[model samples]
Target: MADYLNNNAGMDWDDAIENDGQEFIILPEGDYNFTVTDFERGRFPGSAKMSPCNKATLTLQVKTEDGIASIRTDLILNRVVEFRISAFFRCIGQKKHGERLVMDWNKVVGSRGRAHFKPRTYTDRDGNERQANDVDRFYDYDEKNFPAEDDWMEITGDADDLPFN
Candidate 1:
């Protein structure tokens, strides 16, 4: 089993678990802080399924970037818990006739030169790190499906969690 802890001012809790049917921790719309620990578990089955926990710290901050739009979160991870991170975003609008939504890192800045990033890290029951490069390729959206400004952008990928701390 895995144990999660949230240590923030006024946060009177100590441990949590995402497995066994508990996946997410709900937080109200405001400025808050949290810490996740003892995530050292084996990966589970299924592509979209949750993996085992590794010793790490995940901090989420919800705030507006420029006062125009609300940037839901700023995730900061400490320690390389897993090889990948995945999430879904709400698609708000439709794409143009031939435009497509592609993961172009060049379009955005300050992403460590990672263009079209994808999740490609996995660990087995033996706790061995496995490299999964080809498995991280994007397949859903094509170049001809350009999304509108209001459309939601789903970003999924892997990163060197060691550098975060």
Candidate 2:
């Protein structure tokens, strides 16, 4: 973080506040198990396809041989994307197919699921190109997809019981 503030404070890549090394993890486009590490409730303004509605932004963390990759996905609470909402829930075991259930955002974090992530290239508003991973599809949770005991990623630090300050 210090390096980012010191050297890379501006748009110039040559400048860096500090030399904080960066690791780029490029996940292949395929099926992978992921855990919901974060969730946020947000609102979306009306768009051409639908009216303004509540949105669930989820941060999914996938463990791989290289490292951990974080991908964010937004579930728009609108009829146009209703199937996506249902699919996400089903993938995380929060809901079953052919069933109606309330979206319990409280239990989202720490939940594991399966998804197909693919690389995406998009031009930013500034016309600069950017590379990112997008959730191409969500697969229903299955026993075969569950990670083995040795596959779990160990996160450093111990703040499990502490409340956010």
Backbone clashes, each candidate: 11, 7
Collision count of model 1 = 11
- Per-residue alpha-carbon lDDT of candidate 1 for residues 18-71, written as tens digits (9 for 90 to 100): 336422332323322111111222323323443333222222211123221111
lDDT by residue (tens digit), candidate 2, 1-165: 132246533466665465565476768899888988778899999888799999988988887777778888899999888999999999999898999999888998888999999999899999999889899999987867784663564445778854673
Whole-model lDDT, model 2: 0.83
- What is each predicted model's overall lDDT from 0 to 1? 0.26, 0.83
lDDT at position 149, candidate 1: 38
Q: TM-scores of the models, in the given order?
A: 0.17, 0.77
Model 1: lDDT to the true structure: 0.26
lDDT of 1 at 57: 22
Q: Give the TM-score of candidate 2.
A: 0.77
